[model samples]
Target: MTNENRFNFNDALLTALFGTPSRKNTIDRLGIVCPVFPDEELRKSAVILCERIKKMDDFSWTALCKMAK
Candidate 1:
């Protein structure tokens, strides 16, 4: 698939998983600034970040929770 097409698909998947793109949610989830992209790109980046977050260890989760609070 083309790069644009792949990006769109990834974006759609992220929106389906995370609702809308917002700094609040990203910060809450201990994500980076990449999710601040425009709607399409934001969604795609969010999905990628989500996958990475899922692989984080307990220490990472604890830090995220603390930061979120």
Candidate 2:
């Protein structure tokens, strides 16, 4: 998929976790304002979790996300 069509975390994750984008300023204030990785513990945990999830087959990942909701 192209970048626009790809399931970007900015598009999917934010919408899933926080809802939709609704900013009109210089900053595209969309979704929950998640902090970037300076917060080491959270960042590390997320990275590890993502790595684990990434290892799952496509069907499993899709199911996991579906069930998570």
Best by lDDT: 1
Regions of candidate 1 where Cα sits further than 4 Å from its true position = 1-38
lDDT tens digits, residue span 1-69, model 1 = 445223344444443444333434543553544457567756556656566555656565446444444
**Distance (Å) between predicted and true CA of 36, model 2?**
1.0
| Alpha carbon lDDT at 21, candidate 2 | 26
Q: On a 0 to 100 scale, what is the lDDT of residue 32 in model 1?
A: 48
- Candidate 2 residue lDDT tens string, 5-31: 234443344335533222221022221
Overlapping backbone residue pairs in candidate 1 total 1
